[model samples]
Structures are given as structure tokens and as C-alpha cells.
Target: MASQGDRARDALLDAAEELFARNGIDAVSNRRIVEHAGAANHSAVAYHFGGRDGLLRALVERHHEEMSRRRRELMEQLGESPNIHELVTARLRPLIELLDSLPKPSWRAQFMSQISAVPSAVAVAKEVIGDANLPDDLRFINGAVDGIPESVLRGRAYLLGSMVVGVCADQEAKMNEDANKGNWEQVGRFLIDAAAGMIGAPVTDPDGAVRYPNVPLI
Candidate 1:
């Protein structure tokens, strides 16, 4: 049986997620979270999660455990070798699946989208869920865009993160308006195709000059 403390903690997390997703993280107060959770104690957030940062870490870690499991399963099925598309699919599908598993009007995507914009919150997220640094395919991607300027390569990496987070957040917001409005599987496939295309696209210099040095991309 779950203790009252555990139940209170979970309530606080749920309230915080919804509040933060709907009204940016910084805008939501700890007191508001406690009240929203229906906890008698005003310090419920502190007592349950230690503080705001701890609360954020707990939220990220909760989803991260499932995500890690799904990612491991996907990677195992890929065997020893996988192409860029397969690798991108493996990396992305777990998140899409996670979002799919969530109930309608979910705030997970928006929660993460907001977190990504805050450096401190993003650090906690990265600490819990790891970053976008895909080491295994570094060499492969480097070779794929060997001739492209490092600036362009770096820009694409940033854009890909924003694209995934932004699109998911937007879709979730839309779904809240009409439960049957969106198809996440289709969105996931489109994202996979778009990401793979961006990664594999030929580098065409608009000007006849290269701006960035030929640095090996990470």
C-alpha cells in the first residue's frame, strides 16, 4: 500500500506538471502546487521534493526510466549495424511512444518543452535523461556531412532538438482542444523522415565561399 506521503508527493508532481506546462515553470509557485495537490501543509512541495529543482528532477526521472527501457529495446532490435534512418528512429520512437502512452490533455511534452528553455532546469533534465550527444553514430554522421561547414552541422543539431520539442508541444496543445485532432504515430514518422532528411541533405553553399573551418563534427 502507498503511504500518505507517497500519495501527497505524486499529487504535488502531477499538479506541478500541469501548472508548469500550462503556465511556464517559473510562473507556477510552490504554494500553488501544494494547494493544487490539496495538501494541507503549504510546505508540501519542499517536504516532498526538497525544493523546486528536486521536484523538476523527479518529474524528469519518472519519465526517463520508461524512456530508457524503450530505447534499450529499440536498440537491441537494431542488431550490430543500423543506418542513419534506423538510428534516428530508434532515438526518437521511445519519446513518441511515451507521449502516446500518456492520457489525453497530457502536459509531458509541454513540460519538457519549457524545461529545455531554462538552462538550470535543462541541466537537471540532462543529468536525469542524458543529452543529445549520440556518441555511437558520431563517426557515421561526421562522414555523412564531411564537406558541410561545422557551423551548419551544429545548427542542424540545435534545430533538431527544437523541432522535436516544439512540434510535440504544439500537437499536445492542439490535442487538448480536441482529443481526436492529432495522430502522434504519423507525427512521429514525419519527424523521423524530416530529421533523417536534414541529416542526410547535401551541403550547398549559397555563396562560393566557406565561412566555417573544416572542423570534425562531434
Candidate 2:
């Protein structure tokens, strides 16, 4: 069984995630989180998490553990070699699976999206969760294309992150409406297809010169 302190800490995390999702993370004060958590101590957040930054890191690390586990399993299933599409799916599927498992009115996706907007928070998240850029993953990506600049590939990787976060946030937000329910399966497929193309797409220079014009997209 969890101790009372553990329960209080979890309550604060839960409340903070919801409030941050509903009202941008910057707008939701630590006091609001404490009150929403129903903790008797006004300094419960500070006592439990140290501060808002610590609380955010805790929330991200909690989910990242599960996501990382799922990614490892997916990567293991890929065996010795995998194509771009398979690699992209492996990288992206965990978030979709996590969201699918959540009940209605989930705040996780929105919370992540809000966090991505804050550079400091994003750095903290990167410190905790890292990214999809595993060694093998990067090796595969680097050799997947020829003549494309490494700089362009780096930019595409950042684009993929922003795209996934923004799309997931939008889908979660629309869950409140009667019509237009979020279709995560379709979303997953779309992301996988789009990301594969993005990862291996031809790089064009400003002067209309295309690098790796023969690059095949997945």
C-alpha cells in the first residue's frame, strides 16, 4: 500500500496535469494545484515535489517510463533489421497506445503539448525522457538516405516531435465535442506514414537544387 505522503504526491501530480492541460501550465499556480489536490498543507506541492519544475519533471518521468518500456518491446520485435516505416511506427506507437488506454477526458496529451511550448520545460523533459534518437535508431536513419545534409535531418526530427505533440493535443481537445471523436488508430497510421516520408525526404536548397532527388519515401 502507498503511504499517505505518496498518495498526496500523486494527488498533486494528477491535479497539476489536469489544471495545466485545461489552463496553460504557466497560468496554473502551485497553490491551485495544492487546493485542487485537496492537501491540507498549503506547501504540499513544495514539500512533495520541491516546486513546479520538479513537479513537471515528475509527471513526465512517470509517463516516460511506460513509453520507454513499450518502445523497447517494439524495437525488440523488429529483429536484426527494420525498414523506415517499421522504425517510425516503433518510435511513435507508444504514445498512441498510452492515450488509447486512458479513459475519456484524459489530460496527458494536452499536458505534454503545453510543456513542449515552454523551452525550459522542454529541456527538462528531454533531460528526463530523452527522445526517439536511440543509437541504433540514429544509425539506421543516417544510412537510410544519401546526400541529404545532417542538418536537414535534425530539423525534420524536431518537426516530427512538434507534429506529433500538436496533433495529439488537438485530438484530445476535440474529445469534449459530441461529433468528431478522436481516432487514434488513424492518427497512428497517418503519423507513421508521414514520418517515414519526412525522415527520408529529399532536401532542397534555397536555389531550387534538390539533394538526393532519387530518395525513395516509404
Candidate 3:
């Protein structure tokens, strides 16, 4: 049997997720969260999650546990050497795996879209992942992109992350609106390909010359 506190905490988390997804995190208030949860005390968010930021961190941490586990398993399967495509897939597959398992009309994709968009929220997310050891595929991917110009590499990483989150959020919205509209595996493969291209693209010089002509862009 769940304790009253556990139930309250769960309720708070649920309400927070729904509200955050519907209205960006900054727009939602602690009072709104408590009210939505049907929690008696106004301080329930504080007691259960410490505060708004804590609530967001807890939400991401909860999801990341399973997501990270699957990612680690993927890394293990690929050993220490994975191609750019496999490495990109390793980074991306966990999110789809999680998306499939979540409740219908899940707000997690929107939540992630918002979280990764805001610097403060991104900091909280990084804090959640800080405890987990880095996966091998991540290390490989890092090394693989080592030759890229530092500026270009950083820019592409930002673009890649934003693109994936935005696309997945849109896809989730589509699925919620019409379940049969989106194909999960195909979408996942497409995202993997997109991310791989972004990371492995050839850097072009101002004179229209490709920095690494030998490297395939796609």
C-alpha cells in the first residue's frame, strides 16, 4: 500500500508535468501545482520536491534512470567501437524506448522540449545526469568528432539537440492527436540519421571549399 506522502508526491509530480507541458515551466506556479494535485497543504511541492526547480529535477531524474539504463545497454552491445550511425542511434534510441512505455498523451516530450530550451532547466537536467557515469558510446562519439573545428562542433551539437527535441515533441503531439499518424521506429531512424549528419557534416570554408572533402557528409 502506498503511503499518503507517496501518493501526494506522485500526484504533485503528475500535475506538475501536465501543467508544465501545457504552459511552459516559467508560467506555472507552485500553488497551481498543489491545487492541481489536490494536495491539501500549499507547501506540498516544497515538502515533496523542495520547490519548483526540484520538481523539474525529480521529473527528469525519474525518466533518466530507465533511459540511461537502456543507453548503457546499447553502448555495451556496440563495445568500444561503433560507427557514427550506431553512436548516434545509441544517443537517441533511449528516448523513443521511454516514449513507448509512458502513459498515453504523455507530456514528457514537451517537458523535454522546454527543459532543453531553457538554460536554467538545462542546468537542472545536467545535474540529474551528473550522477550517472558517461556511456562508452558518448566517449566514442566525442572522439570521433575531435577533428571538427571547435566552434563548428559546438554549434552543430546545439543544433542537433534542438532539432531532435523539437521533432520528437512535434511527433508526440501528432501521435496524441492521431495515434496511427506517426511511425515510431521510422521516426527514430530518421532522427538518428539527422543527428549523424549534423555531427559528421563537412565544415565548409568561407571560399566554398570543404574542410574535409574526403569525409562523407551523408
Clashing pairs in 1: none
Residue 182, model 1: lDDT of 65
User: Which pairs of residues collide in candidate 2?
Assistant: none
In the range 115-175, model 3's lDDT, one tens digit per residue, is 7545667678766664112223344666776566544554555566667778888888888
Query: Which sequence of candidate numbers ranks them by TM-score, best first?
Result: 2, 1, 3
Worst 10 contiguous positions by lDDT, candidate 1: 209-218
Relative to the true structure, how large is the alpha-carbon lDDT of every model?
Answer: 0.76, 0.76, 0.73
Candidate 1 whole-model C-alpha lDDT, 0 to 1: 0.76
Across 1-218, the per-residue lDDT of candidate 2 in tens digits comes to: 99988998888988998999999888888998899999878888789888878888898787777877888898889966677888888888998989887877788888888876566677677677664343344546666567766657655666777788888888888874543684888888888899899888777662442232211111
Residue pairs whose backbone atoms clash in candidate 3: none
Q: Candidate 3 overall Cα lDDT vs. reference?
A: 0.73
**TM-score of the candidate numbered 3?**
0.83
